[model samples]
Target: MKNVSDEELMILVSNGNLDMMSILFDRYHVRIYNFLLKMTRDQDVSQDITQEVFYKVLKYRTSYKKGKFSSWIYTIARNVFSDHYQKQKNKDQRLNDIHYKTIGQETNSVDDEEIKEQLHLALMKLSHSDRELIIMNRYQGIKYQEIAEIMDSTEGAVKTKVHRAIHKLKEYYLQKI
Candidate 1:
């Protein structure tokens, strides 16, 4: 499992290698949880959905038949989140549910932290779709092609949407609200 690709591991899982699923879970659970946390701004809900994502992965293991394993898993996570969001439209949220840092940076400066906090606020200002694009593209480091795969769109379209989302984020950040 350590040397195997995600696709191979998932294929093994699909073929009754249930134990191998743990390796996949170990690799992905944090990422899936973080993704959901960013979307929901609720730790408890994110944890619940992250668990459900893995549960669905095992339950629908037979349905996974190829292409990028990461993409498939993200698709499932996104769908699960959508279902949950639809069911619980009035999910509780704090005014500040997240603190964001710049990509690969430790902000020790007060100025930097302030900027990052403002960026987080700006991020919250965007529509859910735009914010999702930013999170997947920038925060999670998911490439446009893979996002396109998870989003069921073309790479070019994903790139354009992400660009627009970034533009919107910039606009909101400039507002400094």
Candidate 2:
């Protein structure tokens, strides 16, 4: 019942420990779902992708690598999103935006809401790659190197993308006001 490292749990699962696999899913499912939810901006699509992520995990359990399981799961989610988006052939410029500000604020704050909306609008204005970079780095707190792995790019490239995306985000907010 003690806390186990992701690598250790993955090993157990690979050794055919079904219970351990369930525990692993329990530990990561919500985190992955939240990440996908934010990225997809559609609860239904997020839910479907969430299930697909787990399915991929289960299918690829034997191929699990060392380092970080988070990065591995994230990679699966990213691929799923890419494939889904491609199949849908969505060409809309608008990206889904979520209300995330005042996350813990108890009182209703109209000003905060407006600012949050503005931020969401700005995020919607970003390209999908920029949006994913910001979300993974800023929101999910994934390391740049790990993001690079999931994204199949260099850490330097990821860092540059984040920097440029932040600059654009600043420009967006400035323009909105």
Candidate 3:
């Protein structure tokens, strides 16, 4: 099963081989969790949403169409976040008490740590759409083509948005310096 591709595993799951979903879960849960964490800035919420993502995948297994599994999973994650965001729209969603330490690589130098902190702060300051773009493109290292597929946009459009988002992030990050 370890040698199986995500799409193949998902196909198996869709056909009632539910156990194959476990392999897909193991492969994507952390990336999905971290992606949610960046979006929500709440570890607990991220954790809950991550679980929901997998649950939705299982629940909607029959809909799997042998497409890029990563793209399908990201689309599910995006929809879950959107649903959660709509419910929480009335409340203050500003980021506070986000921990970059555990999520980020360990750095010995105080300067590096401070820089990372400032970057995260800057990230938190961007509009959610812009922040999402940066997180998908930069932090997650997702290719522009894949991002476009997940976002339901053209690759050129995603590239432009990512470029603009990075520019905005740079401005905000520099302000913190």
Candidate 4:
């Protein structure tokens, strides 16, 4: 039900109330998709990964414990992204080579669109873990405590990481400008 909490819904799902899974999906699919899209920068890949994340949630339903559902789902999403990244490292390298070839020839304009584009490009240039921190804390609006739970680290550590990631993103964005 829409009035029930996410953890309660997941508990119901874990108890074999399969229809509750749809409610969970409807609640989170867009957020998860956007998170993946920000990380992958590929629409098709993000869609596939988003589907895979839900599939994983269903598959592991029995393992669901009484906790914050958001944290559990994000942990699953992060793992899925990491697995995809590992498997596609070589292909990514080739794509990066092609991307770099074209990047040099692009004009360094300072229009509104150009600034937004440069910010996006700078985000993409960040290390995967750093980018994840920024995407989670800045873009996705996840609290540091929830991020720490998902990352299996202390809240203090998450705060520090997010701070450093934002600093790096700003430096890179300024360089692009």
Model 4 earns a TM-score of: 0.89
Candidate 2 residue lDDT tens string, 47-124: 899899998988888888675787888988999988887666565432342323323445488887788779877887
Tens digit of per-residue lDDT, candidate 3, span 1-177: 788899999999999999888889899999999899888867788999999999999999999889999999999999999888876664754344434335645778999879877998888888878999999988799999999999999999999999999999899999988
Q: List where candidate 1 sits over 4 angstroms from the true fold.
A: 90-110
Tell me the TM-score of each prediction against the true structure.
0.86, 0.85, 0.89, 0.89
lDDT: worst 10-residue window of model 2: 93-102
Each model's Cα RMSD? 3.6, 3.4, 2.3, 4.4
Lowest summed lDDT window (length 10), candidate 4: 94-103
Q: Could you give candidate 4's per-residue lDDT for residues 59-168 as a string of tens digits?
A: 99999988899999999999998988877775665223323212233555657558767988888788889999999998899999999999999999999999999999
lDDT values, one for every candidate: 0.87, 0.81, 0.88, 0.88
Clash pairs detected, candidate 4: none
Model 1: pairs clashing at backbone N, Cα or C within 3 Å: none
lDDT of 1 by residue, 1-177 (tens): 488999999999999999999999999999999898787766777889999999999999999987799999999999998888766655653333433233455767989779877887788889878988999989899999999999999999999999999999999999885
